[model samples]
Target chain A: MAKVPVQFTLNGSEKAEFIDSGTTLLHALRDKIGDTSPKGGCHQGTCGACSVIVDGELRLSCLTLAETCNGATITTTSGLAEGGVLHPLQRAFLDTFATQCGFCTPGMIMAAKVLLDHTPNPSREDVVEALSGNICRCTGYEPIIQAVLTAARGNSQNAA
Target chain B: MAIRRGRGVAAINYPTGMNLGGDPTQALVHSTPTGNFMVTLSSVDLGQGMKQIMAQICAETIGVPTDCVVVDTADTDTGPHCMGTFASRGTHRAGNAVIQAAKEARQVMLEVAAEELEVNASDLETDGQGNILVKGAPQKSISIFDVALSAHFKRGRSISGRGMFLIPRSYPEKETGAMKPSTCYAHACTVAEVEVDDETGEVTVLTVKNVFEIGRALNPKMVEQQLVGGSWMGISHALYETTEPYYPNRDHGGTDFNQYLMPGPGDLAETEIIVLERPSADGPYGAKGPGEMCANPQIPAVANAVFDAVGVRVDTLPITPERILRALKAQAN
Candidate 1:
């Protein structure tokens, strides 16, 4: 396969890479940058597990060709945490047992973060609308919804 | 000498927003032969956290940290083959086993303590730390480890325990000729309200409520989480999934998560879980199976919700708007 040069900012860092047309942004993020937080669930963009924010809009990385990134900043789930401590959303998820298999967590959290960033104090309906793209097989949305609400309430986290 | 056997039972709870239709029953027992205690289960975790619930049951029954009680998974190699793990039978069945095993271990400890301390078995009490205390004297004590060590070294004996349980069967009112003691039932009711686009037939689940009657809750948080996830799976099955038909002409196709349309976050209604606790006679800590029971109602609930919104009842699953629109057009003609 022929190769193409691509440049994109990952998690607020500058990066330049060369990849073939068939190489997806997900592949570059996972294989090249070695960030495994954004999972590859449905490479066809149906399963939103590979969703990422491109220039502040939620986009499916699997569907986007690597060459199209070209100097765009890509933020993944790894960037959600600070210095080994979990993000508030991650902590809330654990406390409320929102995450079960954890396969959809990174994307779910990313999508939720985008919503929260835009609407800091979103209503329950807003949270639902924001997370509609992610999928979790365990912890029905009840616990997850509660966790997001709890995080918004300033509850202490890191409890097992 | 604590062989308490009781009839298993089931109860139902319907949430304000949702209606449910299913039955699940579970039982558990704990026993001790010598002093070695083991926790066993017929429930499969499937990464759903059943193992943790089993450990918690042991810890609560025997009074130890959940981590202290080791879990043994489904093994036909072990004695007493269970019905297998699909119906949330772990805490109910395995929990009872842990209780029986822990009680047996406790008996051995009491006997040894009574002999060494020159006190009657009735006069001894187990401290929360699995230690034996001589009632009035707080300082004169022995840990479970000490008792286990004594039984192994000084007494030249070993302690062991076992447990067994089974759920009562349901559907057919009374078991007549071929009835084996299948006496456990867990009930749930789920409701969903939805909005469907008349043009595209894209049905959006607006809200969902699940109300269940579990005999007991080992961990309420975990139970609620699993139920929610399960509801989503059911909703996915009802509205978005397509299965390849075995018949020559039908359209049955797809492989794995890629081709299949499982319910993403977008497909789910804002879910609410209402847990109703009504302890069963046979379950451990009054705990019953609640895992698979919730999934059953979610499908029908979504289907009904779509009907409420668009006045079109979807008999078949994966009720896409395309199908709904087609149904509407067919009705118009």
Candidate 2:
């Protein structure tokens, strides 16, 4: 194993870290940056638990080699809420009870965010299509779909 | 291009809690100087909202608001004994224990409030909103917080209570092997509508409608989430997952989920759930548990639907397209 220096912006902060060559971005974020919000569900990229926004694109952090993302920006679930105010998707997820176990939540939320960014007000079918990559064992897909649909309707989040 | 649709229904019942004596869970409730109460348990949440459910029980029992009760679980060293969180026992078993503990603690609270107000302990009643008021005089009241301070400092009595709930064992009858298994049983029924392609043998689930009689839904939102998650799991088990003859024939089989099929978001169907409340006589707040029963009915419902659609009975798990085609061919022959 060889350690390599990689530089990138994590949650809007500049960071440079040394990691082994075979390290996945999920490990880099969790092991190096100490951000455990991005989960390591299935390292083969099938389970979207390790979802991260890389340069404004939702990518599975487990499949992406840390060294390959040397100069890119990364956003994990930790960065979704700004200044203690949760994003609409995050709020909707809580309100709709979209999260259960929360292991796959960050990825699911990231996946839904990309869809809303592309289509501000997507139909139910569109929400389903965007969530194809993410898998949630709890709350089924209906709650997540409803949460995303609610967020798309310009409804403000009310966290309880 | 010939797609045929059919509907099928299934009903199932499951017992709550483990069926053995000494399957006990202990709860410890102690009041804080800030007038809030903390409950400690050894049962794990496993993301099932056990902590929240326990908090709700404690709040109601102690006559405090739901927010004033905090639950801390899964510290094996510090927390008391718990039989774990499975068997849908978090609500029925552990919840019963919490109710007992909070009730004991509330007795002391009323006593202290009585002494401070110069009234009989029986005359003081909790408003269930963090206040102790005299019966028939709602306007005359003192906050539970101030009374907690008096109990801790002036009266010098510890405001803490411990509780444990255990089920008794019943001897089975010699002839029938029948005995009490659980304190209560939860029932569910599901109807699944699916479409099958006559040519390709591909099956598409369209909708799932369900009704559950879970005694009483302790937390209605959490109950709904459980049902929704369970329905998909049933779909995955019935139609997508498989581990079969390929293992001995091939050295390496589908090792991960990519090779082992599971349903994704694209495969999700419309879901409608109806919850019926039938209060349990013994359960805390007339509530029973609804954990594993969530996924039981979905499996057979889909299988029955496929049979209804193609007039072929494929009695196998993961009712794959290959199996459906094979069954269709056999029926044609």
Candidate 3:
């Protein structure tokens, strides 16, 4: 397989990289770009742990190929925080005790963040639908729902 | 507090004896000769909030804030040996260790205070605020920290504490003919009302009401979260979640995140957690382990609820829609 040069914007910075033909976007971001926030749970699109926002749409980075993400702008879990402060969703998780093992946190947060980005005040149903792909063995969905609601309240407060 | 069954006991000694002690927070911190706080805890957190509960036990015993006392998990080299974190042993075992440690520290501090106040060690009283007060002399007082530092500086001896709480070794009560082998059991009864689709066999759990005897609840909010979260996992295991085989080959039929499903928002209805405050004689602050205990009963409770709803009993776990349909068909036939 021939290694191809790829250029893309990652976490608000433009990066040029070259990767083998079979390399996935997840590998490009994790190994080559030194960003490991988007975990490789199931290389298949079944697990949503590899979910990331590309051009305002949530997509599973594991399913996305390096070639397809050329010149694209990508935002991962590492990008969620700004200036050493956690995102509202992260804080909400801590306050609500949403995270246990912390393995599924990045993906679950990204999914919930994407849902809330579109629907600021999402109902429990909406939150479930958005996060249906992410699997967490520790917390049953109650705390996750509570964390989402807390983030929604924060979003409204910020808006006000 | 034995849980008596019909003319017999489920376990020989289901409900163990309860410990009674006055608010002895001052003696743990004020006394000297700090002992090793030994504990047995399972590595897994079943959501019972044992970590915080252990902290509370140490804090209350040693006259310190909850924030100051750090709860440790079961690692061989940490301090003392502990059982892995299961069966709700965190507070009782670890809390007792902390109590012992604090007691040792208190004894030494009291001795130093006795010398400073020119009074007999037995006559001096350790106040709740970690101060040693001379009887009938309100003006004569010394702080626990000062006494400890002074003992270390003047006597050139280290002021420390240690504690160890072993699970009571006992045989099943012979006359009772029961399996009561648990160190201390926390009892709980949960009622779940669920709705079933007669045609599709899909079950929507409407309400779950649980009343559990958890020796004591150190942090109510943390407890509630554990209950709610544990219940959710239990519900999923009962109705939705399953672990299929993992295959390296893509062609092989395997269970991954997509095929192996669990519960989401639409699957649940209302979840209610009721914590019973029956102080265990063995536990620190009287709290039982609540995390994994609730999880074991979820599948059976939901299955029972399904039976209540549509009159079908599921023998296997994860009473899926297909299994429900088959059972309903068999029942109809």
Candidate 4:
């Protein structure tokens, strides 16, 4: 096996690392960059726990190859906040009590961020469709759906 | 393609705390000189918010704000003896232990404050802001920080308290095989509504309405999570999930999430919950366990709902489309 050189911008910082060609981007982020926020659940790319933003698109890190991530701008749940101020999704999740066990929080938040980035104000069905890939065993989807809607409302209020 | 809707109800009970034989949990509480209180518990949080509930209980008992109490649920090497966090025993078992320990520490704190203020400990009351004041004279007060410092340096007192709670074993009845297995029992009643397709034998759970006598919620949000999560688990077990699809062959169940067939966001049903506060006599702050009880009742409720929807009883796990179709065919024939 040959070691491949990969360079990517993570959480707004440029990082370079050499890894085996077989390593998934999930392994590179968690093992190499030391950002454990993106949880590894269901490595089959079904459960969205390992979700991340690659070049402004949601991609499952568990499925994305490390070699394929070179020169890509990556964002994770760890980068959602700036200087300890929680992101809108994080605040909404807390306020609506959307997260329980918190194992799926990072991925759920990432998915919500992507939805809000595109839709801005999504309907309940839209939120459901957007988060259909993510699995949260604890909240039963009610609170998470409500949290995303609330975050969208907040975004609209802030814009007003 | 007609969809028939029907509803059914079931009620169930769950015991709080493990009381097989002297199931004991201990707590260690000590007041730091900086007016902060530290409570050591061996119970794991497990994302159930046990740490938050215990911290709130400790603060309430000590007459201080919740933020002033630090619940250090350290591992077994550092923390006190807890039988781990399971069986819905964290709030009922560890909570009582924390209450006892906090009260003892509060007594010593009041005593030190009494001596410093030249007043009897009985005459002083905690303002819940770390201040001990004379009952009538608001101006006469002493901070807990001063008392804690005095207790540590001058009075030769450590301001620490220890507490342990155990449920003595109740022998099983010889004939009935019945015994008191826990300190308290929590109850829940659930009604599940379902829509059944007679042609395809598909059952979709529409809504779940529930009433829970949970003693005290402790934290209402946490309790609601258990209820909602348990409802989903119950629905999954009834319609969507199974391990022994081929019985008597314990080779392997469904391997991954796709094969396991758990309920996703699209399947989430509407829920209406009514929480009844019937405090338990023995539980701390009259709080009982509602963690596992939520999942138990919905199993029977969904089964009954399926029967009501199609007038056939399929007494199997993950009531599949095939089973429903077979039952309907048998009934029609």
Instruction: Give all TM-scores, in the order shown.
Output: 0.70, 0.93, 0.77, 0.96
lDDT of 4 by residue, B4-67 (tens): 8989999988898777667778998999987899999998888878889988999999898999
Ranking by TM-score: 4, 2, 3, 1
* lDDT values for all models: 0.68, 0.87, 0.68, 0.88
Q: In model 1, what lDDT does residue B139 have?
A: 84
Better of 1 and 2 by lDDT: 2
Query: Taking the tens digit of each residue's C-alpha lDDT, what string does model 4 give over A34-76?
Result: 9999999999888999999999899999999989989999999
Give every prediction's interface RMSD: 2.8, 1.0, 2.7, 1.1
Candidate 2: where is the Cα deviation over 4 Å? A155-160, B242-254, B329-333
lDDT tens digits by residue: candidate 3, A76-152? 98997899999999999999988766777888888998899899988878888888877777777778888999999
lDDT of 1 by residue, B1-333 (tens): 121111111224322111122222222333233333456554455767767877776666655456556666666455355555554655666566667766665576678767777788788887666667888986887776667677777775545555554333424346554432334577777777766777777777666677877768778877777777777776777777786523255565667665566665445567777888988887778877777776767777777666666666667667876788888788678
Q: List the residue pairs that clash in candidate 4.
A: none
Stretches off by above 4 angstroms in model 3 are A1-21, A25-36, A66-73, B1-50, B72-79, B106-155, B173-179, B242-254
Over B169-277, each residue of candidate 3 has an lDDT whose tens digit, in order, gives 4455788856435556766666777777878777777777666666677788777777777777877888766553222344534267657776655566587777778
Q: Which ten residues in a row have the lowest lDDT in candidate 3 chain A?
A: A133-142
Task: Report chain B TM per candidate.
Answer: 0.79, 0.92, 0.76, 0.94
* Worst lDDT 10-window in candidate 4 chain B: B244-253
lDDT of 1 by residue, A18-116 (tens): 777778999988998788988998787766788888888888889988888787878888887888998888888888787777788788888877876
Which of the numbered candidates is closest to the native, going by highest TM-score? Answer: 4
TM-score of 2: 0.93
Model number with the top lDDT = 4
In order, the candidates keep a fraction of the true contacts of 0.72, 0.74, 0.46, 0.65
Model 2 Cα lDDT, one tens digit per residue, B171-224: 789999998887788889999999999899898999989898888788999988
